[model samples]
Target chain A: MPIACEETGRALTVRVEGEIDHHAARQLMEELSRRLDAALPKSLTLDLGGVAFMDSSGIALVLRAYRRMVALRGSVTLQNVPDQAAKVLKAAGVDRLLPWNE
Target chain B: MKPVNEAKLTFWSRSANEGFARTAAACFAAQLDPTLDEVNDVKTAVSEAVTNCIVHAYPDQLGLIVLRLRLYPDNTLEIVVKDSGVGIPDVDQARTPLWSTGGADRSGMGFTIMESFMDAVKVRSRPGKGTTVTLRRRIARRFPG
Candidate 1:
């Protein structure tokens, strides 16, 4: 997984590319958490336009990111969700828990 | 029903193998000429099954995992994932959505995902004997353009 972070004032945009599975989620989570801690932005947006596939592991990763933002008193949003990832998120009902843009 | 074609793969239970397992299953299913959606569904279901083996079945150490693929004359694909690790004592509770022993990072929706993506999912396990998940889906045959 390749993750890129862009900081624009108080908001941070994270672009995640490639597959999200049990194998990749760990590294993705660690990298995302590290970036989140370093930025500590008031608003976070995860860009998943480049994601090709995701399973239930993506749901957990998103929830963790959401909880971290909640703990930090920040807001988080998911954008550009691909069709494959959307199906998994929807099946797990995680799509309703957070704000996501198709 | 007898399968027209079949194959089996045996590998160690490692998280890194999750992608390999799913991709292998998808590749095996490709012969059916399934649609993109059908292919994704198989990939997702296989990922969940293999993930269970990696995360729960062999939580403590590495173990063997076997994946079996079969093709039916009816354009159906059958996949079997077996792990000889610690088996689930209560399959019912384990099948419940959002029920997970896997820590904070796990959503515990593996079974649900498998059920949703596959036409049928059957799990058979015994304590200390290991677990086997059988998934089947009928691929839609596309008409000639």
Candidate 2:
């Protein structure tokens, strides 16, 4: 699996270890939703450190999680975003909305 | 006049093909010796265009998507992504941010991303014909300002 999740305290940490394109996003959505529903944590922290690239598909995935977290009255944090992926988020003017670290 | 270099790719409209499409376009543009940032911009544009085709063009079915990459004599790169699926009814509404027919998974920022990453993005579509997105960007060597 390209996605790994762990429930640490009040935050659900998800580490994606590959490209975040459409193909990967599909599987990611399933896993993420399961975790988000299984336990409604106060926060969802996505470690994009391992993501080599991202596109609108990845952005779509992030948006899905963001919406879910919002519904749960939680927040989403994107950490260690790669340059290519960051460029995509910045172009969409969403670098701030996601509360990214790098 | 013919372009200095060009490549055309046709792939099945599976969600899996989106990343392949982007990497392929980036490799094609790499021949121009563009800056890493320029290459990233092209990749982002390709990603948005191709994702739109897979998600919107054939919303319920699978189809073929075509990508065309051409490098001109003026260091400008042009990318064209086309799909034979359903066409957009209103290109204007489709281009708006957060305006999505793709339900929950889409950001509705496909056109915005393409336009922001590339110099220009033009869309052409008819009711049942399909949609074609043309993106052009001029890459230049960095100069100390």
lDDT of 1 at B89: 96
**Pairing residues by index, what is the TM-score of model 1?**
0.96
Give the lowest summed-lDDT range of ten residues in model 1 chain A: A93-102
Q: Relative to the unseen true structure, what is the C-alpha lDDT of residue B104 in candidate 2, on a scale of 0 to 100?
A: 69
Question: What DockQ number belongs to candidate 1?
Answer: 0.86
- RMSD values for the candidates in order, in angstroms, are 1.4, 2.3
Q: Which ten residues in a row have the lowest lDDT in candidate 2 chain B?
A: B136-145
Tens digits of per-residue lDDT for model 2 on A16-45?
A: 888877667778888889888997999999
Report the lDDT tens digits of candidate 2 across residue range B1-145.
5699999999999987888898899899888778988888888789889988888899888899999999898778989999998899999999988788887667777888888888989999987899999999998845533
Looking at candidate 1 chain B, the ten consecutive residues that score lowest on lDDT are B136-145
Taking the tens digit of each residue's C-alpha lDDT, what string does model 1 give over A1-102? Answer: 479989999899999999999888989999999999999989999999988889999999988899999999998899999888899999988777878876
Q: After superposition, how far is residue B25 of candidate 1 from its true place, in Å?
A: 0.8
